[model samples]
Target: MRSRAIFLAGALVMVALLGGVTANSVAAATKTTVTWKLSSMTAGQNEWLSDLASTNSPGVKTWSKTGSCRFLPEGFKGFLSMGTGKSCTLTLKIAKSGKYPAKTATHTIIRAPSPATTTTVTWKISSLTAGQVKNLSDLAKTNSPGMKTWSKTGSCVLSPKSDPPKLTMGSTGSCTLTLEIAKTSKYSAKTSSKTMILALYGVGDTGPAGGTIFWVDMTRPEGSQYFEAACAGWSDRTCGFDLNEGSRDRLATWGCAGTPITGADGTAIGTGEQNTIDILNGCEDSALAKFADRLVLGGQSDWFVPSKDELSQVWVRREAISGMPGSDENYLSSSELSANLHIGMNVNCYSGCYIHIQKENNGYFRPIRSF
Candidate 1:
């Protein structure tokens, strides 16, 4: 009741100030309400909305603004925006005229800051093969959570026909994937491209050992690891899930009890196999849990624990493997950083996780052999 009296008194005052003539205008003024939206935005993002300033009054509507943001004309119909660039408060006014006079309401908008960054979108692989199936998330990487798109020139089709689409190489020929991530409020936009060839034995193909090839050291270099994208994937023997389990048993202490082992501490891409061998020879606790060194998968028994970098290679290209770990999964590397701490790789929505973790903490492990 008190609020109604205040509104009626305010409307009468507005009528008196405007020297109104019509009775209907007075009623409309008392019944109308206005709303303001305070939004934070990034400069140059050019994001706009339809209700930055709005009202619920009949008859012809009028709106106005005061700020650095683009107003009125840039806003279509009832739409409004603070516009773009350096921040400032935006004062807005809206009015509704019924019969003889117009009733007005006013409000202010809040401004915010935009952090600057150099955004980049990169392809995980440089080439592909025809009739090969691949996940889009595995093939491209972005620094922002913005839109991703592609424009190509060849026989290629994105499959499952859904958002964050998967890729299936169509028939034959060469095409390009334009890796792009558009700007969001926090980060800038970026784009890059990589050519994918529809040939045979590309990075994501199956190696002679029937494992997904992950690293093809470019020039073959007389003794290259493999000519593809990943190694064989194993899901049965998880690394850090249990203390009375495989990795914690004989594979305990990252090879030696209290000191870093010599050959087992390598953290590079081509060093995992050696690191595994060294661990097997040096640390032999009497337990019958299958470690990476004792694995005999894919018709070969040379499988070893991947080093830090090798584990990363396997992780980044995990989508190409048949049964790789999903999001929020972890893999132990053969690289030991300190007492009971080893390097490992983890998969998540956002990544940067090549750090030293507890050897018997969270996540799993998979062994990969360089054929």
Candidate 2:
């Protein structure tokens, strides 16, 4: 009975020792608690965490080996995405004797600036760009907001070194005016204030007279009225009226009324007879002589019937008369001539003939007389 009791006591002691050992092992494992979180996800980095493990894990059975990853900090999980070739960091809050270690890894990605974009602006030809001429008139045509005023540097010559580049304006924003090249001259288009001419903006009353320096082009119904008689055939009495209505009228009136003085016998008035008839018929009929007997224009009595060269002068100097009264009609007259390529004549009239005034039309005349 004594031996049995002793053996039972020893067994009890052994059971107690084993239980304590098991308890110690469990406490050791639970003491090592770990807290982890992803810090950053750099560019080119994968959205998911590449590596995750408890720092306190032993080599034999690491946190990753168990596949029992714990929860991260409340707000950190949402910001952990990583792009390609980029990186993300993980922050660990480890207890000294707990389940995790304390450490952080940060990764950053690289980026570049975006490519440049192409932009364009409409710029008018200011001056003669290099080897070209600056043609304001031509440019104004066919362009929105036609070319406005030009700068002083703009040039008329085609070989460059003329005017600066410029643009016109209209209802729309800044716009470029198209250029029209002349068929005869190398000039892109006619430019220069030599001739005072301006565009007809809108219809208005026959503007104030004499003060206007420029001319406009307006076609009135009066032109077609006496077209036949005005376009006389053959005789110098009618002058060259067929070539063009306006031209015939101008030359006939100017040349006929502006012819040299003659004696009653139809002979040229040699040196000193008053030749008021020349001025009287200039650009109008005898009745409408504005400058007959030597009228004054620009303070001079030399204003005679423009010769053929003078007519061409009129063409080139068309601008000088722009914007003035009757300019629009004059331009229409030119258009009429251009359409037919007509050539009227201004001949010398020695024989006595009545200088007919364009019945209803008004004209300017300048007579010749020795002062």
Taken over the whole model, the C-alpha lDDT of each candidate is 0.60, 0.29
- Across 261-318, the per-residue lDDT of candidate 1 in tens digits comes to 5577788777777777666666664111136556655566666667888777776776
Q: Pick the candidate with the highest lDDT.
A: 1
Query: Would you estimate the TM-scores of all the predictions?
Result: 0.41, 0.18
Question: Pairing residues by index, what is the TM-score of model 2?
Answer: 0.18
Runs in model 2 deviating more than 4 A are 1-293, 321-371
| Runs in model 1 lying further than 4 Å from the true structure | 1-200, 227-257, 286-290, 360-363
Q: Give the clash count for model 1.
A: 7
lDDT of 1 at 143: 76
* Model 2 CA RMSD to the hidden true structure, in angstroms: 26.6
Candidate 2 structure quality by residue, lDDT tens digits, 168-208? 22322222232322322212233332211122221111212
